[model samples]
Target: MIPKESRNELALDTFIKAHPHLLEEMKELSAEDRQQQILWAFEDEAESRGLEAWELALELIAR
Candidate 1:
């Protein structure tokens, strides 16, 4: 099985790739701000879809 940390990393990567518009939006921010925004957006998206943040990340990786 994948290590938990690695799984989360992969999930985040998959999530980012699936949302190219996020990258575009992030480009307007400083590195730290971009990181924060991405995390917030990720969490918001997961919540909107009725899944826990990590659950949505893993689901994205699965796809």
Candidate 2:
């Protein structure tokens, strides 16, 4: 299963999609690199929201 933090980051897909440059950069990454990037993004967002990494993941899955 993916970590909670990872799920939160994946949720950014909408925002990422809205930014063509970011989307292009994301598309150019290898699958593994992309996954890591997403995970880190989640961590950042979770920190900003004052939510634990796992909490974000649970929230994402619950949706």
Candidate 3:
């Protein structure tokens, strides 16, 4: 799980705030683009946590 402090550094809440626009665009994206965006966000969060990529992938997938 991501710590609260890490969440701030990753600007996760900020990203989520901009999600409406992203979501709208996402609807028009191919499946691969959607997956890429999710992976990018996951990687950003994982970097903030000093976690491995696989860990982040698992966490994100679980959600």
Candidate 4:
């Protein structure tokens, strides 16, 4: 089984790959800041859909 941290990273990677426009919008930030922005955006999106962030991450990676 994958470690939980690894799973989360995979989920985030999957999320980023599926949304290239997000990367385009954050091109000016440092890499760390860009990742933080993406994480917050992902969480916000999940909240808007009434699901926990992990659930959205899972759904993204599953696709």
lDDT of each: 0.85, 0.66, 0.61, 0.88
Clash pairs detected, candidate 2: 4-57
Best by TM-score: 4
RMSD of 1: 1.3
lDDT of 3 by residue, 1-63 (tens): 876556443553445454556656677778788757755875676889998766654554445
Q: Write the per-residue lDDT of candidate 1 for residues 1-63, one digit (tens) a residue.
A: 889888877887887788889989789799889878888888999999999998997887778
Query: Which clashing pairs does model 1 show?
Result: none
TM-score of 4: 0.85
**Per-residue lDDT tens digits of candidate 4, residues 1-63?**
777788788888887887899999999999999999999988888899999998987787677
Worst lDDT run of 10 residues, candidate 1, spans 8-17
TM-score, prediction 2: 0.58
Tens digits of lDDT, candidate 2, 1-63: 767556656655543454456546688789888768766776786789899877755665666
- Give the distance in Å from residue 14's predicted Cα in candidate 1 to where it truly belongs: 0.9
What range of 10 consecutive residues in model 4 has the weakest lDDT sum? 54-63
Q: Each model's TM-score?
A: 0.82, 0.58, 0.44, 0.85
- Per-candidate alpha-carbon RMSD to the true structure: 1.3, 4.8, 8.7, 1.2
lDDT measured at residue 15 in model 4 versus the true structure, 0 to 100: 78
